[model samples]
Target: MTDENTADSNTSTGTNTAEEENQSELTAVRYADGSLGYPAHTLGSDGNPPVDTIDLREYTAEIITWTKATATPPGVREPNTLAIVEFEIDDESVRAIGQVTTTEITIGDRVEPVYVSELRDPTAGIREPDSQAWDGYRFKPIE
Candidate 1:
C-alpha cells in the first residue's frame, strides 16, 4: 500500500518498461482542471461540459467512460386523458377536469389504483379486466 501514493501515474506509464520502443497514442488532455483526461476531438454534447484534462491515479490506472443522455420527454398534454382514481360501479373517478395536481391515464390505457373495495380485498392495482369484470362493469371505450 505504500506505493499506492503514486500508483496511478506509475501504471499509466508502466509501458515504459517494454523492450521495444513504440509511440504511445494515449495522452492526457490538459485543462484548467488537472484531474480530467479528455481525448482529442471528443465533442461534448449540448447541456454537458467538455472534458479537458486527465488525472493520474497515484498507483493504479483507472479507466473512465462517458456517453450522451438517453432519456426522451413525454410529448405535449393529451387534454382528455386523465390520471386514474378509484373505480365505482359504472365508471372510474378521474382527476377532475383542470385539476393541477392530477394527471390522468389515457381512457383506453390501464392503471393501478391505490385501493379498491376494502372488504373484498380486491387488488387495488390496475388490472386487465377479464370478460366477467368487463361484462359486469359494462366497460366501453370513449370516442
Candidate 2:
C-alpha cells in the first residue's frame, strides 16, 4: 500500500504510477510505547523507533469536530467541509484532520476514509500541476 501520510516518492509527483492508479492509503505510525500518531512519523514521540505502520482506512472514526472553509488556499474547493476525527485502534486513540465527503455531518458521527483521485484541482494552484500529488482520502460519514 502506498503511504498517503507523508510526501514519499509515490506522492511527490502527480504522474507517479501509484498515484495515477489511485493506490493511495492513509497510514499511521504505531510506537513501541503503545502510542499512535497520524501522518506517520519516522520516530516515535518518545524518541524511540516506530513499532508498526497501520492503515487508518481499515478503521472507522468518530467525528470530534467539523467546519467549512469558505476562504481556502489555492486549488482547494470553496466552502470545503473538513473534520477532525478520532480512531480507536488497539486501545489507542489516533486523531486526524481531512476533508469531509459532505457538509451534512455532526460531531460524534462515525466516518471512514475513502480514497479520492484528487483532493483539489492541481491546475488551480500556483505550483505546476505535476509538481506534487493531488490524491488523498476524505472522511465519509457512515450510516
Candidate 3:
C-alpha cells in the first residue's frame, strides 16, 4: 500500500503551487542591511546596487498608506509638511518621503515616482564640478 505521508505531501505541494502562480511575479528589494526599496537588485562589484531605470520612471502606483508630518526637527532648512508614503511599484512595495501639502494625499490615490535634480553651488563656477548630480526620488500623485 502507498504511504499515507506521501499522499498528503503531494496534495500540499499542489496547493502551494497554485497559490504561488496566482501571486504577482514582482518581488521586493529587501537588502542585506534590512532596508526595503523598489526595482529589486543585486549588489554589484562596487558594492552598490542600481535599481531599474524603466520601472522607477514609467510605473504608476496606488498609495497603500501615508502620514503627514507635524513636527520640525533640528537643523532642517524649512519645516515643510512631509508625507511618508507606502505604495506599490509593479506589485512590490516601496516607501518614500515627499513634501506635500497636508490636504493633498488620499488613500488609494494613484501616484508615480519623480526625481529632482540636485542644486549646484554658485561658488563652484562653470569649471564643471568634480561630481555628478545626486538626484533623488519622491512619490507624487499622478495628475
Q: RMSD to native for every prediction?
A: 27.6, 7.8, 19.7
lDDT of 1 by residue, 9-103 (tens): 22235454441133222233433332233243343333234444332111111112112222322221222222222222112111211111123
Model 3: clashing residue pairs? Answer: none
Please tell me which model should have the higher TM-score, number 1 or number 2: 2
**CA lDDT, every model vs. true structure:** 0.23, 0.80, 0.46
Tens-digit lDDT track of model 3 for 1-143: 21111211212243546533443222345443445564466763346674433334445566666654445443221334345556554445566555432246677777655443332232344544455333334455666
**Each candidate's TM vs. the true structure?**
0.18, 0.81, 0.41
* Clashes (candidate 1): 18
Tell me the lDDT of model 1 at 28: 34
Worst 10 residues of 3 by lDDT: 2-11
Candidate 3 lDDT: 0.46
